[model samples]
Target: MPVLVFGSVNADLVFALPVLPAPGETVLAPGYATLPGGKGANQAVAAAQDGAPTAFAGAVGDDALAEVALRGLREAGVELGRLAWVPEPTGCAAIAVDRAGRNLILGGSGANQSARAAQVEDAALNPDTVLVLQREVPAAENAALILRARARGARILLNLAPAGEVAPEALRALDLLVANEHEAAWLAGQLGCGADAASLHRALGVGVAVTLGEAGAAAATAAGPLRVPAFPVRAVDTTGAGDAWCGVLAAALDRGLPLDAAMRRASAAAAIACTRPGATMPRAAETAALLG
Candidate 1:
């Protein structure tokens, strides 16, 4: 099985701050560092690091920042054959992380807005392919890809981060939907359903997984609800933890692991990511050792 990530890529500008500033308040950090990021790219790296046969389909600018944005994916062994070069500047994210590891992120779409569903080849949508998507790109493009992948019998996983308006048909087409508490609530409200995992599953007619930061994660499926407790670890930076969970979960599932087993791996991967700085995701061995 293979995993295909259709999403955004960005060069993350990370600033380490003592505290996140309040609205209209000014805060300063010692300095900032550029790192590979973007929800789509992060998840693709995570899946590849988890040992999945992964490919990334997206667009990047010809700017110098394009290399910075793509370093992780290339290093992770994610195939970039579907990547396109556009005239827009590469996407960038301004991330401010406090000493406590919480983060505030502001993104500039740049070249990411040019990413299209057509970038993914028809051959990429097959029964053995796992298509991973996020809200970082245009909703219409995602919807188009979702419908195509569904018709082709590929398993589709959508991480509804930074939740916004998505078509009902697209929601129904998903094999699984991953989201944090806030995103889950937003989706539930939009669908006129309860915010609980079971309610979401019922409303969407698909598997729903709601990530609970400290407590852990819970999933709702035909087998009923399942919960996994968070692995105890010292926190450093929580950025990209959710992306790690989603990617690892997709990888685990692609490897034929049951949902419960996959959730455990995803949880462990997320915990490991939290102990690292920036948007760093843990390798498969690190996650395995932690699980053991």
Candidate 2:
């Protein structure tokens, strides 16, 4: 089975500050580093590191930053044959992490806005395929891919990060929908429903998983509701934790794990990711060791 991620890619500028800047306020950092990041790219790396055959389909500029933005995915061995080179600048994210590992991020869509559903081929989607999506790209493109994947009987997982408008028809086409507490609440409001996992599942007619940071995560599916406790770990940077959870969950599902078991693995992977700086992913062995 293969996991396909169709979303954004970016070069992340990370600044470690004592505290995040408030509105109209500026904070000084000792130094900064550029890292490969973006919800989609991080998730693709996570899936590949977890030992799944993963492919990434997105757009990047034909510029110097493109390589930097693709480093992590390339290192993780994710196939990038479907990647596009656009005239627009590569997408970029400015991330500021405070002492508590909390972060504030501002992103420039750039080439990401040019990402299209046509980037992924029809042959890439099937019953054994796990198609992952995120909100960094255009919603219409994501919606189109969802419908296409649904028609091919692929397992579609949409991580509604940076929550935005999505077609009701696309929501109904998903096998699973992942979101953080804030995103979940926003989505609930959009659907005119309660902000709980079960309510979202009922309203959307699909499984819903909500990541609750240190409080762990909860999911609602036709099988029943499930709760996975967060693993105990000292946090370093929490930027890519949710992406790790989504990617690992997709990998687990592709490996034939049940949803409950997949959530457990995802929770463990997320904890491991929080212990690392930047958008780093844990390998399969590291995740298994932590799960034990």
What stretches of model 2 exceed 4 Å from their correct place? Answer: none
Query: Model 2, 113-141: lDDT tens per residue?
Result: 99999999898989989999999999999
**What are the lDDT scores of the predictions, listed in order?**
0.94, 0.94
Candidate 1, poorest ten consecutive residues by summed lDDT: 273-282
Q: Clash totals for all models, in order?
A: 0, 0
Assess the local accuracy of residue 238 in candidate 1 as a C-alpha lDDT between 0 and 100. 94
* CA displacement after TM-score superposition, residue 210 of candidate 2 (Å): 0.8
lDDT, residue 136, model 1: 88
**Tens-digit lDDT string for candidate 1 (125-192):** 99999999999889999999999999999999999987998888999999999999999999888889
Q: For every candidate structure, what is the RMSD over all alpha carbons to the true structure, in angstroms?
A: 0.8, 0.8
Off by over 4 Å in 1: none
